[model samples]
Target: MTMNALTASAAALFFNHDGEVLIVNPTYKDHWNLPGGAVDIEQGENPYDAAVREVREELGITPPIGRLLVHAWLTVPGRGAQVLYVFDGGVLDHDTQAAITLQASELSEYRFCPPHGMEDGLIPPHLAGVWQQALIAHAEDRITYVPVRL
Candidate 1:
């Protein structure tokens, strides 16, 4: 057994001027997600770099990423354990927001959602719960740890 066998992912939390968090609608999933993806360890990318890469690829903007906001772990049915990292992307300005260009093939749309009750159930509970906690941690100026159970 190799000690390095693990799956990891990185995500970012970007807020608009109205304090709404940015969420993306992936064409492959019914739920909206943060601008992030699995860490390309094979390509020598760390969690932080992966988050940056994902943001650039998915949103076509290169906003500066900040410290870690949320760290979580989830049990995958068949893929073993997965570690997830969420970074504080800070607030996007009008010019940065205007530069967003979604990857047409991967993402269908994007929106800035209120941190409270997400309108129309667009976000799943697992994500919503974690997101809410992340918001709380941000407000308190600290990092948050979340455990996801299936």
Candidate 2:
């Protein structure tokens, strides 16, 4: 059997004070990216848990899961499809000033980004819309309460 090239995944759009963003620089491709991954369609898998797991795996720290940030559909050049689950989280604690048990294979660096400085940062262009949506959700007060899709 073969798996579809397109896939659904969850990502975190963490934020800090003064309109800054939390980002992880992937060690795999040496590119900065949001923290997230594909869903595990198991017996009792939770999206929030998945998000927390991803943060721990990638950043060597725990991010306080605050609320549902927003949703995005990404389109990569070669990847067939990209449906992303974005969440708003807060940085609880860590020594970003130095290094933790960094996921050397997946992430090399992590940083808190000021809103204005992100223009020159190396994030996927496809995630621009995602960032916009996250901001909107945050302002509207709906970010912390995403409704279930039934």
Candidate 3:
């Protein structure tokens, strides 16, 4: 049996003191996304490193990434088979939130969105589901492995 090769991506979940999650509006994509990008394995960058790098590149912040939150295996249409690593960005204080500066070429704007209405606010149905699972895992203080059809 031939096994399909899998690509990897990493994202970080940042929640404000009010519990609103941070989402970014990228200039290249119509939908909003979590702060992250694909792992730069070619440059010897691991998933965790990718997460940290993406945050700094996209948001211009160097907040410490917390524990691993979720591991999602998805067969994203067009993107193909992949594994996604989500890390906890922890709660962002007012001072940290004030420090964010968006990369104009990549991102347009960012917002702290209340968790309750994420499905209506976030783009791509799969992300909403994954975010929901991630939220639960964060609250439970455990890592969740998600295998879902997207």
Candidate 1: the clashing residue pairs are none
Q: Compared with the true structure, what per-residue lDDT tens digits does model 3 show for residues 1-150?
A: 125667889999999999999999888886888999899878999999999999999889999999899999887555568889999999999998999999999998999888866789566677778888889999999999998676
lDDT of 2 by residue, 15-92 (tens): 655557777787665457777766664635566777878777776667567777775554444545555677777543
Return the candidate ranking by lDDT, descending.
3, 1, 2
Q: Give the deviation of candidate 1 from the true structure as CA RMSD.
A: 2.8
TM-score of each candidate? 0.91, 0.72, 0.91
Off by over 4 Å in 3: 1-5, 77-79
- Backbone clash numbers for all candidates listed: 0, 1, 0
Off by over 4 Å in 2: 1-5, 42-44, 75-80, 91-101, 143-150
Greater-TM-score candidate between 1 and 2: 1
- Give one digit per residue, the lDDT tens place, for model 1 in 1-150: 134357889999999989999999999998888889999989889999999999999999999999998898776555567788989999999999999999998999999988874645887666677777778877888999898874
Tell me the spans in candidate 1 whose CA falls farther than 4 Å from its real position: 1-5, 77-79
lDDT of 1 at 39: 96
> After aligning candidate 3 to the native by TM-score, how far in Å is the CA of 111 from where it should be?
0.2
Q: Count clashing pairs, candidate 3.
A: 0
Instruction: Order the numbered candidates by TM-score, best leading.
Output: 3, 1, 2
